[model samples]
Target: MCLNLKKGAIFVADSHFSEVNVEFLSFLEKLKKKEIETSQLFLMGDMFDFISGESRYFVKINQKLIDIINELSHNIEIIYLEGNHDYNLQKLFPKLKVYKRESQPIFAKYENKTIALAHGDIYTPKGYDIYCKIIRNSALLIFLNFIDFNYWLSKKIYNKLIKKSICSKMKDFDSFAKKRLSYYNSDIVVEGHFHQGKHYEEKNKLYVNIPSLCCNKKYTIFDGKFITTQL
Candidate 1:
């Protein structure tokens, strides 16, 4: 979908994979070359793997990574749409702009597209409140981050496990999105949380299933022209 953006056009994302993949980081660098700092970055959910144990907000990215962001702070506005894993968003550091919401519809006239940015966790028929509690304090998350977090292999494995767990479609939230889209009838609905990367479209509608790609395979981007990229 071509939502032609203004220079204010930015990047939207979810489940930031982290500094594990060389290829992905290279991709980010390429975008950075275009000026990542000056652009805005919207995170749909799961920006990091801090859903657990010891702290209110745990960061997988350490000093070096924080340093990288400090460098880009001047040029970008980083916003985060809270996901099940990252419920206590207000606790997230200043760098992450966490929106305490279930979902929201955004209008990008400059890009000529209407975007529904949700972390995709609401799909659970039961509810996110329950899931959030259990997932938030896993010993594994704590142990892993304490040791060698961000190792590509471990992250890949983690992603695989998360996928397997979402085997059943959470119709409640899914239908919620569909209904909302009908209400807004936006040009596109881009979402993440399922960790599945794909796109769906109708005559006047589009639904984007964003993958939980780490910082490397990160999927959304925008230029002065439009908001377009592969998930």
Candidate 2:
């Protein structure tokens, strides 16, 4: 979601962190150890490969990373915009400000410019929209949790996700972004989901695709303009 930037904020996205990705856990450890300093931490989404609040098994699976985040939240202003892969997190990270897909394009002021923040999966087809709603529902999540945690359903889902390729080059991305920006009322749109890690400017409006921390160890900092850097 949107937050006014009083100081530099670290924006991380599409990390797709899981049990296999020890790097993501290390990054959390660094943040917890004060190696990575920031007044604000923006989790742009998909930070977890698959995490839900309803499932105790999934919570235990990522407990180390979750604990680090929970500890850091005591001091840092952490904002989590739930991604496709990571939703239903309100129960998991109660201290952090969690934004769901429907509540996005959260608006904020950045140096006299209005900024909109989202997980970048908005304005999709009607079918996908419905799917998002169903999946994020509390009742549905509880039902899934019953089956997933009791059985080995979580393992099956995790296996499928791990096999899929998350990194890819989006052809004609400028055109795609141009169309997306037209739906926004802000001067700048910052989002992450496509894992493109690219910036685009058109008609004085800026669109930032924040880099994935899992992909090339990339992250972004806002210093007047968004700056992309590697860890």
Candidate 3:
């Protein structure tokens, strides 16, 4: 679902928060304490390394962070764009505005310029789309939860994810941006996944690849133009 973009909006992407790296939790605390102020909080994607609404086991493991976000939602308008690592969050965050992968690239307006926001995996290969569909299906999640009686499956997946390196530099990113921008119809396209933390313009469209807070503690703030900074 698309919503209006308010000025002074904060955009955080790819935190990939896990038990070992809890900086994302600390950031949430800052927001809760009013240490950070914003009209809206945009969780671009991968906020959690792995979280599924169907599994209570995964939810319990990250309960503290969940609690903080739920509390913050009472006051702040949070728009969560579900990433590859996190999906099926309707039950996890009932109050917050959640958008799944299939319903992404939502439209908004920033200073009279049209904006398209997504988790940045939409334009991937066909195999990726099929994989996403299978993993994001509520029925599949329920089946997985049923088989993970002792949470062994969840533990194994989490362990593998924690060991994988999620930060890196991509080559020919400008060419990639040009291709991706063609799929969107907007003045500005904002997304998080590549962890590129850069901005580019193709034709009349602007593309903002938001940095991962877990990797560099960087985020984007919109004034007249999107500006990246470490918080």
Candidate 4:
């Protein structure tokens, strides 16, 4: 059986929360305070600048947002698709459904149409695939955690991440979308990695590259069709 995609569900992608980009923190605050409401929440990832379950230092620094998300999960359904910047999160978020990259393009049924969801990192080159595997390896993360004792190594990495620019427009996005569609057979293809907030029809199939909350200050609401709303 396919998952049910609920109406009024909210989809957030690539917030990239860090010391510099705190828009996601405010968004979470609104959710916690009931300023915004949704029965289903889809976190289409890169939700953090960097994070992993085995990295104690990163987890500790991000504990506040983590606590709020854990609390919210009890009252709502949350589906998180792990992106490159964030993975190994099953232990961190036991209440939510977390899909790792290896298990992506998860299918759901929405209004009799098939919907596919991913973090937009698949169909990548072999080198990137190998890098993703190595980065998410538990042993390597544990070793990094050991080096991050006293927040030394982790702090440097965090500083660099926050300074890096992530917002940019893609060239030839129309062709890019068409090429990407060649890999999927679903009625709707939804992803968030390019940081491009765009939706268009190709071969009668809906393609939605969800907006980056950090870049666009927007998120998407799905009733029958996708609607992008500003913060």
Please list the C-alpha lDDT of all candidates, in the order they appear. 0.51, 0.85, 0.88, 0.92
Best by lDDT: 4
Q: How much lDDT does candidate 1 score? A: 0.51
Expressed as tens digits, the lDDT of each residue in 1-231 for candidate 1 is 222334644444444434343333443455467634446666666655433223422344433434444455456666666665555545434665555544344444544555556675543456665755555554745565566544654556456644443323444555544654565556766666665455555676777665545532546554432345543
TM-score of 4: 0.98
* Alpha-carbon runs more than 4 Å astray in model 1: 1-38, 51-57, 103-113, 133-187, 215-218, 223-231
Worst 10 residues of 1 by lDDT: 50-59
**Whole-structure CA lDDT of model 4:** 0.92
Q: Candidate 3, which segments miss by more than 4 Å at Cα?
A: none
**Candidate 4 residue-wise lDDT, 25-54, digit = tens:** 999999999999999999999999989998
**Cα lDDT of model 2 overall?**
0.85
TM-scores, in order shown?
Answer: 0.58, 0.95, 0.96, 0.98
On TM-score, the candidate that comes out on top is: 4
The clash count of every prediction, one per candidate, is 14, 0, 0, 0
lDDT of 1 at 214: 54
Q: Which is better, 1 or 2, measured by lDDT?
A: 2
Q: For residues 118-216, what per-residue lDDT tens digits would candidate 2 score against the true structure?
A: 999998999999999888788987887777645488878888888887778889989978887998998999999988899889989999999877776
The residue-by-residue lDDT of candidate 3 on 182-222, one tens digit each, is: 99988989999989998899677899999999987888888
